[model samples]
Target: MTDRRPLVAGNWKMNGLSAAAAELDALAKALADRPAPACDVMIAPPFTLLAPFVAAASGTPIAIGGQDCSHLEPGAHTGDIAAVMLRDIGATSVIVGHSERRQDHHETDDLVRLKAEAAHEAGLVAIVCIGETEPERDRDQTLNVVTTQLAGSVPDAATADNTIIAYEPVWAIGTGRTPTAADVATVHGTIREVLVERFGEDIGNGLRILYGGSVKPANAGELMAVANVDGALVGGASLKAADFDGIIDAYR
Candidate 1:
């Protein structure tokens, strides 16, 4: 087992505004006097709030990130923001290949791979997400599907410092239905095996693998305690200061 520090990252998704700044403020205050964990803490808000959030998190253990970014550095992609731009605005990380993008926008693994490369090229940490849907799970193809996504979405140059993997089962996200501990162990272990096979034991063992999907304060500690479950990619629970802070406390 590697000694990689755990990380609890909040995905604010499309929520938050200057008015919502209170949430982050509250979170900052809650984390202030508490002993920092052996893990890292990150929050990914929408593009519109990245700068303000980054500013608020300065001098704190909290790191701010972007939800997604365009693969191209700069272009006429109009609405699309590039990874370099996010970095320029003080974002320390970016989430790539999230299940929502894959399902809603029909994004393929190849596209996710390119975006991850863009994040790497821009010197930003990439949190690549991969998991199977409900049907895939029901059909007993969870491992196969997850492995394929892990293989295709993660780039070859991936390292512990530059990358993190979040397993967010499409079925579990926002549905309040989490897999059993044994189930989570099985998948995470398989993911570790794949990483070792592809990246060699040294780097693979050091990689951080997070479990996401309906993760809340109630279950955060239990999930974090599981072998290979280094952290979480929180969804709705991340939108509120109290809830997100609770999940962070679970790491302690």
Candidate 2:
């Protein structure tokens, strides 16, 4: 991974409420007793909870991010959140092109790219997600699909400092099923190749590439150990402080 710092980010994903601040409190306490874990940590709570969660994690090492952001700047997009608004509330990063956004909302690659550009425009790191569906994986098109998404969804302005890539196979999300370590290595290796090729060695090799989908404490170590995998984008396991701490233990 060279000098790329690991980033373990929780994607709370349509989950959590103001009460969830307790979990951040607990997580903060857990980290307070130790030297910082050997990785970067962040959480993208629902929009409604961002401010509170940011407050809860204020003095801690954890960063607060948004789950999504609008491709357009502030305007009458109706229910859409601009990256600038998230930044205004102390969000340092934003997720773009998540599989759910791509599937449920039928977002095209161009739109995802625009959103990433928007994040950069607002001075936020864009965690861009890409992956193949179950059917595509079954047909052995994983590499091709990821390559295409990398080409289309990631913007030209992306740099190691402003972008992160997350690979989340749609079928495995929240299903308690995870790709084998070797499988993860293969996919991450492909992603790294595309990034290096497109952005050149310096920028690509410095960018962090994370794995998501079924990433619980039990499998976090194995997944993080995979080549080219700099960290994770955790889902269900991240909802609770204890479980999320356990996953963070992989770095500790």
Task: Give the top-scoring candidate (lDDT).
Answer: 2
Can you give the lDDT of residue 88 in candidate 2?
A: 94
Off by over 4 Å in 1: none
Cα misplacement distance, residue 53 of candidate 2 (Å): 1.4
Error of 1 at 25 (Å): 0.7
Residue-wise C-alpha lDDT for candidate 2, range 38-139, written one tens digit per residue: 999999999999988888788789999999999988888899999999999999999999999999999999999999999999999999999999999999
- Model 1, 1-252: lDDT tens digits are 757888999998878777888888888888886776667889999988888888989998899998998889798898999999999999989999999999998999999999999999999999999999999999999999999999999999999999999999999999999998889999999999999999999889988999999998998888888899999999999989889888888767
Candidate 2, residue 63: Cα displacement in angstroms equals 0.2
Deviation (Å) of 149 in candidate 2 = 0.4
Query: Ten residues in a row with the worst lDDT in model 1?
Result: 30-39
TM-score of each: 0.98, 0.98
Q: lDDT per model, in order?
A: 0.91, 0.92
TM-score for candidate 2, residues paired by index? 0.98
How big is the positional error of residue 148 in model 1, measured in Å on the Cα after superposition? 0.3
